[model samples]
Target: MEVELKLLLSPADNDKLLQHPLIAAHARAPVRTQQLSARYFDTPDLHLLRHGAGLRVRKIDGTWMQTMKAGGSVQSGLHRRNEWEGPVDRPWPRLGKLRKLIGDQQQWLDVLAADDLKARLEPLFVVAVERHTWDLDVDGNHIELVLDHGHIERHGRHVPINEVELELKDGDPASLFAFALRLQEQVPLRLSNTNKAERGYMLCRQTGTVPCRAQGLQLAPDATAADARLAILNNCLQHIQRNETAVIEGDDAETLHQMRVGVRRLRSALKLFEAAAPCPPALLEDIVWLGTELGAARDWDVLLASTLAHIQATPGGRSGVLDLQALALKAAHAKRSEAAQALLSQRYTRLLLTMGCWMQQPAPEGLEEPAQDFANRIMKRLHKKLLKRAQRMDESEPASIHRTRIAAKRARYALEFFHSLYGGKALRTYLKTLSSTQEQLGSHNDLVVADRLLRELNQQHDAAAATIQFARGYLQALQTSRTPDLGAIRAALHALRLP
Candidate 1:
């Protein structure tokens, strides 16, 4: 996730802005209030959310203060300064003040609106601070409290995290640097320049993923390896069952998508591990079937987005471009619907039962699986080799990087497959970088795949042909631009000592 450091200054504090180096224009004017909401999302363990909402008042002095806000926060919610403004001192007693207004069981809802702003606020910097947040219900409507103190404590797949945000909810970008400079001294805790939402997402995406059974055991003994492998496979299957339950219950798209990705990765890891310790042919077959069905929809969603993006970006010159693009999009949606339907079928349940029964049997004696430390070591070794291979392939033959990336991804998955057992801050950090790099390469690869599909569309018009050519060129250019400095990224990955 990205972090940021924020300094908020309201209209009342506008004159204070004159103390700063950046407030030359607004020496007499006050910062205006504009409506804004920032939400933070996370699980109890802080694995999923560390987000918030803010209605900021910005001054020319580079300070921006948060005001009463509305809307849903990702993990944190409804933290506005007006609520915190009483006779309270710095780091106001938020929970105490909040509880006095509304009890723990009732949730509060407020609609805040303001309109008076100029400035795109683009090319902005995110100022953040580490802070702990509680996801409990305050007065029933889910309320998260973000304290002034930046605190993070890792437990299982969650953590205690916080943030300090800085931005003019009214869309002004001036005074950011100057405000940051001032806040650096007033705030007692270490200031962070990261976006909590981005940081939390990266943390969740990289860390806190449940592990597979294969990750828990060493592939040393034939019998023990077999038992451990099956155990991991069952665990992976159980992960699927858990996620499937959420999907069946109509979980949000993001959560469901996360679960779906887990299912696919676990299934893939199990298949690879099972190569050494073969599972029942029938059991393996069932797992593959589920993965394929789910993967089809997921893959289609990814492809469709790219295709639509391409067509949308095209100029007004191409004839029949709309028709071909429509056909491709329709095909993708159809595939997604079909896959979703298949996942909800009775056969999926039967497969789930079969897999569950397999996981229930007791462990064989002296199984003595591989240690977590050892497995992590192997994963890192594989990651380093694969990364080098990816860079090497980038220069010589990009085609080969595809396979090399898959190998690195597999290793990363193998490690993350047991995200529950060895999850922590460092591991989370590595996984975050790994996943980001993987995504960039993966997106590049997706464009390559999409190009192949477009080339196969068999369009005939000269205009259509030209459009296709332009689209392919656009994709190629995008791919080139996305390929970042892999060496430095790799170094950063290495810096994170994975366990």
Candidate 2:
């Protein structure tokens, strides 16, 4: 297994990193440089990619080496993957050698033998890099820091590479993050989940930004609460980091929304597992801070894209809707830009590093209890709390209803995190009902938020005051027209059985 953390850097930052005092002070040996050229291979249909594998043959210092990397998980730039490598005599991939490494792993054997796989394999793209490596022993932990500079080329097109990788040679994973965070103070570094082969594949296929989706969780039946909690957190971080590029560079609203969702899920997980695996109050506060930053931009996006559009299509709604939308959208776009910039900020980077380091440490005491037992206790309490809140939905004020929505959301997230343990047709039915009620409550809450934002817009911009006023009135009427069926929602909540 190969354990490493990959950080993206600009050309200037790369230079600054080399001269950084920490690198100079901690160097265990003189820096060594190597010129590496690797050619990735896959079937025309991307069979290996489909199986979560990558194959490449590289020439380094007049020797050929073939490497295969199998399934792995990446969280907050740290990659843990199964890798096999051996010297090769030819440039083409030696599938036989890779197959031998599989060593009677039935699944891999099947994949390797599928439909004349060897004959179908072809070179995809070439990655050439001048790598400068530094071996360091920081407080007894051995680490290898490498700076890779070059380009990935395919069909005469190329993309520059300026990345730093911190591979753990022999040490606790926490040390790697600590070192990376120290370097981040001197150089602008972005946590990157993309590997060289993935980049090469993207270039080969001319692929565009791919929005990330919530990953499914798979937990063993006898797993402990700590095991499940760590898995959930890892998945959340991966979703957030995987979509970072799309959120920042592709300007995709969905990607940004998914990233925000990831943060929310993490916060929810922290709360859900509090009894078993308590999180630091400071860490919780930091996560909430990040979520707020993401929410500000996403709230505006929902208002402009969905709420405003709906109003503009209604009767007497088009008169001033576009003007109001234009003004609000201008401000919303500014907020989104600010949010994007925050993702690249050192503060945010530190949060990721801190979270990664925390995850590597041991879980709190009670979390060693069986996962099902812990989940049952937690879910029952959440469901009861949600039911109590649901009872007052009709008579409660808007603030109360909003609180109900949040309760429902938390309960829903808890159910999702533990769904695999109690999965059944009944559980699915309960989830569907919960989802419906949650959506209605959420829509109501959105309207409440939108009203406040429109009022703020009216107060902030004198020129758009009249249009904003019109919007507020329209929004009020819309909110008045769509009364939530609280009775139905309450009944659904009552019907839910603890899974």
Candidate 3:
């Protein structure tokens, strides 16, 4: 297994990091510099990448080496993955040699030694860089820190690769984050979510990023509560990071929505485990700030798509509300820009790095309970509380119902995190009913937002006064007439069982 934390460095600060005092103070050996030029290979269609694998043959300091990295998870820029590396006699990869190194490991042997695979392999991109490395002893923990600076090239296109990788050699993983935090005091670094191989492929493919949905996680039946918590939180972070790319690289409102959902899911997961696995309240606060930023754009997006379209369908409403539509879209666009900038901000990177560090901490001894038992206890309490709150939706105002909606959403997120610990049929049905209730509440919540937004615009967009008045009146009437899905919410709560 390869355990490393990857960070991006500014080329201008490359020398700054090299001269950082800690690198020398904790150095176990003199820093070594090498010229590394690697040729990455895959099928024309990238079959290896599809299966979560990367293959490369590199010449480092005049010696050729072959390496394969596969099936890794990158969370908050920390990567944990399976790696197989060995010397090769020549510059080209010898598949048969790689298979022999597999040494009867059937899982990867089947992947590396497939018939006709070697023949189909083609060089995809070349990664050329100057790598300077150090073996360090920090508080008795052994680490290998390397700085690689150069570019990835395919055909005539290229992207710079100036990154620092801290690989755990013989110690605790937390030391890597600790050392990184110290280094950041002297030099600014961004936690790199993308590795060299992935970057090389991205350069080769020249593909655009789209919004990524929350990934599903499967917990072992025998897993511990700590295990489930770590897995789910990492999954949530991955969800947010993927959509972060979408928002940063593309112009899709859905990306913000999905990223907001990821934030909310993460918050709920932290609350669910608060008793056992507590996180710093400051971390939670930072996340709430992020959610608020994302929600601004998301609310406008919903108002434009759902409420405005409904008002547009009414008699003469199309011509009446046209100005409001333009105002809403303009507001949405502005908020989207702000949200994207938030992702690029230093505060955001600090939050991710801190959360990633927190994830590295070992679970408290008291919290090391079995997954199923802990899940049932936590879940039953959540279900009962939700049922109690939801039963009052029959008489509550939109404000109170909005509270219930928040509760339902949190409950829904918790249910997803624990889904793998229970049986399929009953949980699936409960989840479907719960989903329906949340969606229905969500639809109603849109009216609340639309009303507030239009009121704000009524104060600002003076040229569209009549249009704003019409839209606000339309949403006001809709909210006044709307009813909560008492039956479905109650049914969802009822269907949720203790097991």
Best by lDDT: 2
Candidate 3 residue lDDT tens string, 1-499: 8999998878999999999999999998899998889999999989899888999999866789999988868876689988888899998888877887768778787777566888999999999999999999999999999999999999978898899999999998888888888888888887878889998888877877877898878999999988888888899999898888788767787888899999999888888888867779898889999999999989988888878898888886747587778888899889889998898777787788889888888786656788888888877777777787787774347766777777777777887888887766777777776787778888888888888998899899788888888777877787667766577677757767654
Ordered from best to worst lDDT, the candidate numbers read 2, 3, 1
Clashing pairs in model 2?
Answer: none
Number of the top TM-score candidate? 2
Tens-place lDDT digits, model 1, residues 1-499: 1111232223343334334433332322343332222223223333212223322222212333222222231111111222322222322123244334333323332211112111211111122332322232212222222333232222234433433354323321222223333333433222222333444444445643232222232232333333445545644544454455334434234434555665666665555554344456787787678667766555545655654566567575355556657656666666556655665664554454344344434544433455344355556666677666655655335676576567657766776654544657867776777677677567667776777666754463444566667667777776677665666755655565665
What's the CA error at residue 478 for candidate 3, in Å? 2.0
lDDT of each: 0.45, 0.85, 0.84
Higher-ranked by TM-score: 1 or 2: 2
| Model 2, runs deviating above 4 Å | 394-396
Q: How far does residue 199 in candidate 3 sit from its true spot (Å)?
A: 1.8
- Estimated TM-score per prediction? 0.46, 0.96, 0.94
Q: What is the lDDT of residue 346 in candidate 1?
A: 48
lDDT computed for candidate 1: 0.45
Q: How many pairs in model 3 have backbone atoms within 3 A of each other, for residues 3 or more apart or on separate chains, i.e. clashes?
A: 0
lDDT of 2 at 489: 83
